[model samples]
Target chain A: MPDAPDAVEQAVRQVLTSINGDLTPTETMLLGELEALAQEIQRAKREISALSIGDISDSHIPVATDELDAVLAHTAEATNEILDCCEKLENTAPELPEGPAAVVNDAVTRIYEACSFQDITGQRIGKVVTALKAIEARLMRVTDRFGSVSSAPAEPQAPDTRTQGQQLANGPQLPGNASSQAEIDSLLASFD
Target chain B: MDKNTNILIVDDYKTMLRIIRNLLKQLDFNNVDEASDGSEALTKLRAGNFGLVISDWNMVPMTGLDLLKEVRADARLKNLPFIMITAESKTENVVAAKQAGVSNYIVKPFNAETLKEKIEKVMVHA
Candidate 1:
């Protein structure tokens, strides 16, 4: 009793329904891949945070010559670990997806590379810190020696008998007399 | 030098000044004076008999460099040794200080070791 045209339309509709149903397996496969990638990205981020490179570099550790080499070596080792992780991720990354998923994958890759670069940078900074510590230690020793040499008390003598040069070298003589003033002025001029 | 030998330390940071004072005390140089800025330091220098000056480069009212210039220009204090403590690590700053007749230079945040070396070097060379 159905019209011929209606019957033909129903057949076409059935075919379209079957074709859509066939895509279920493909969609499930893509979704599973996406879920795995998301989990991988999250795990990578957690690992990066656990490495704590920023905290280590920012810390105010007392630096010494002996420790400097060790610190740098440790930094390099840590960086290497991060790089290895990134290499693993790069190698295992699934075939590129289209649309927003591709964008996310690209972002994740860039982050991994950035983390690797930071590690390298941190090692270089560690070396510099070590060198600076050595310089600081040397300077402190010199300051200590000067302090001892300068602080030793000389034999006591009458103030008036002391030479003007001696008084200025000792310190500014109190009671700003013309003689002391003249002596200090003359000494200051020599620097010019 | 005895307990009477007056030394002046100038810096903007109170903590730094205290550290220097404590270090000076350890070396048996008990007669140490402190000023918080270049102007204050200059005032103290003029008011008291100071043997040596240790100053920070970056300070308000006057810089360590300016204070050095003033000390050098003054007839009475011309021979006074001036050491500059700075955070700047540039070669140019060091060269400039040497040219200005600075007795020595030390970069910060320095430990006690670097401080000692520079002081000895300046005392001997200057």
Candidate 2:
């Protein structure tokens, strides 16, 4: 009962459907994938929230930089102290016999040369600090794009429960982190 | 090398400046001045009459290479002895320093003898 054009159109549509097959299953599959992706994103956000790798404030970056700088400062100070001793000895070397003065001068010169280690180490640490700064900048950009999902800083750490030997020991630490060498020596002496 | 020739030592690290100054003193070159960076060194170079410039290659705001170029470009400072100190002995760094009119180069962690040798090689005093 349909008109000729309508009939032709319907026949063409039937042929196309037969060739292409039904599309409902494909559409359902796409929607299912979208829903799965949404769930995955939520899970990732939760995982990120649980991670304690510093907050969006990135206080860690500056702290790390300060630690590196402290390394430089401590080494420089020690090296300078050694150099001072060497220089003092060298200054008084001329008052000694010629042979002994020559020997002392040679030793002092070697010490001065070795003191260069501080400069090399400082340069190496400077490079690391520079790299950390660059990484922090990238992190800032990422945080800008997809804000921080992490929780606030953790609570204060619990008191030490380890035995005497198992006590926390990150010796050779930064300026304020651990006790000085003199303190440790005094403590070890008292323990005797 | 004239022991009394006024020398300018440039480094951002105070320790390095002190070390170099001490070494120069051992070499009997006590007439030395210090600058913490290239820009400050430039100001001193323009203001004083320094026979030699011993500078570290790396510094903020202005590098030794930049300072070398500036010195070479200046009519008065051109041909003044310039010794570059680099932490690494990379070939490209040597080539670049050479191209920038550096009179000589010294790699880091050098002994007094080496410093003396380089200073003797580069420094030309009137």
Candidate 3:
């Protein structure tokens, strides 16, 4: 039997396909990951909403409140961690596919829009969470695309013997300087 | 028409400032000063005897429009030629800038030739 979810899924797939051109394979994989994460977040939201919300016994209400709080806290922390990862990915990627970057930029813009909506009515943080999840998904796609492209064999180039300032002037370069190397080491240390 | 005409370039981004300065040097306009924002531009304007002012639109503390208005209001600096370069490409924004007494306007991500043409137009018209 045909279902509404099936139709929605088909539409989403069509949109993704239409917009997927020019993305590196890594970007596609990242985007796929992001989509999965967003689905998980949506399920979490549904589960949280499904809990009892009527004038139940006081003891039950406390338990419900505690459970809701715990869920909310977890979601918030996870979202923040995802955003941080996205930021790091963005910083490391030298160049991103233009189409995917536009999509990610659009997602970031949507996050701001969602935050504004929440601020006006003093609503729950769920709207913000949803927007953040969307942004995370977009960023993951962008990074993944960049990663795939970067990993591919490149056309040969002249050996780079330029100073740090010279390289910076030319544009972004891998960390080779003492200061930049130290920073990368520290960042890796933290990750470990 | 000395090559050493004191020119002030104002923008919020350090990268943009350097790019503009380099472009100006190529154009033989060597006497260039820079400010990171509108207020700093004004401070420099008040301190130095600059012949031309090239400013960006969006900035904190004050905007290029505010600086233009202030410059127009001040009797001493009223005749100092001002050109605005901005990312805003809307006709309304251009009209507003023209109404505010800007000598010229150039949309950002512009090339060296476009910048030179606009500057020349402003100089000729002025």
Candidate 4:
């Protein structure tokens, strides 16, 4: 039933009485403890967040995948050109000397056999591409769930320069990027 | 088997199709056609008179295995000779292709001789 001003005064008196009017006792201690608990909860939240997969922004994975794709495609194209030239030479090589002609034809056949790298590498690259696609999908889901780690909005991707087949072609890689042909041959032989 | 038998080569990768076609040409088999994937391959198969089907095992939209199943299921095309080319040399994949009625299997990175041998084996029997 008290007026507003009287009500405020009574509330202040009750709070002072709780602290024994010294103003730096029970109430102050309780307020400080509440603040500390709040800070502790905040720290716990941070720890839990750190336990997540962690931020992967600015990662080179995309660039690496793209570069691998480009390199493989280029290798296949170049090899195809070489095979074409070999085929042409085999066709055009004169029949004057049957021995030389046969030798040249055999050499061309060997080169044609070597060009099989395209098909083999293409399959290998297809497997890698499938894996990369799955990873990219999972990464997108993760970003959607946890939000982006970077504050900067992602830069818009430039238009891809690769043509249709070029994008899909994953040709043979050098020994540095993939296992050597000997390793592959051994693995295949094991299957037999 | 006639060297002039109409052949259909299917692969999503253009380079692969080209390589296969070139290999076929080298073998003096000039009647060759191409499709980009299993779906397109099926369309071509249904529309054309192809004697043999050469397909890559992995492709988007539909795989060669799926195409083989479809081909076998279609009564009109059930007896078509199908050759599967794959990079996977796993026993399971080979068995699966066999179970699906694949006429022949060629592992990737194969030479023209390998291709010729498989085609001859399949065509002679087909």
**Each candidate's DockQ score against the native complex?**
0.06, 0.09, 0.03, 0.29
lDDT tens per residue, model 2, A2-62: 6334454455556556777663676546545655665676666557546543563368888
> CA shift at A3, candidate 1, in angstroms?
63
In model 1 chain A, the worst 10-residue window by lDDT is A164-173
**lDDT (10s digit) by residue, model 3, range A95-154:** 668777666644543332232221112113333444445655554454444335255654
lDDT of 1 by residue, B1-126 (tens): 344568899976554565566556545677888999778988889888887899877565677777787888888888887887664334445555566667876655454555666566556654
Q: After superposition, how far is residue A164 of candidate 2 from its true place, in Å?
A: 55
Taken over the whole model, the C-alpha lDDT of each candidate is: 0.58, 0.73, 0.60, 0.72
User: Per-residue CA lDDT of candidate 1, range A31-81, in tens?
Assistant: 456556656655665565565444333343453434666765675566556
Top model number, TM-score = 2
Best by DockQ: 4
How far in Å is the alpha carbon of B20 misplaced in model 1?
1.0
Predictions ranked by DockQ, top down? 4, 2, 1, 3
For residues B38-99, write the lDDT of model 4, one tens digit per residue.
Answer: 89999999999999999987776777888888899988899999998766455455566677
Q: Candidate 1 regions off by >4 Å?
A: A1-192, B1-4, B124-126
Docking class of 1: incorrect
Provide the TM-score for each candidate, comma-separated: 0.39, 0.72, 0.42, 0.65
| lDDT (Cα, 0-100) at A108 in candidate 3 | 44
What are the runs in model 3 whose C-alpha is more than 4 Å off?
A1-192
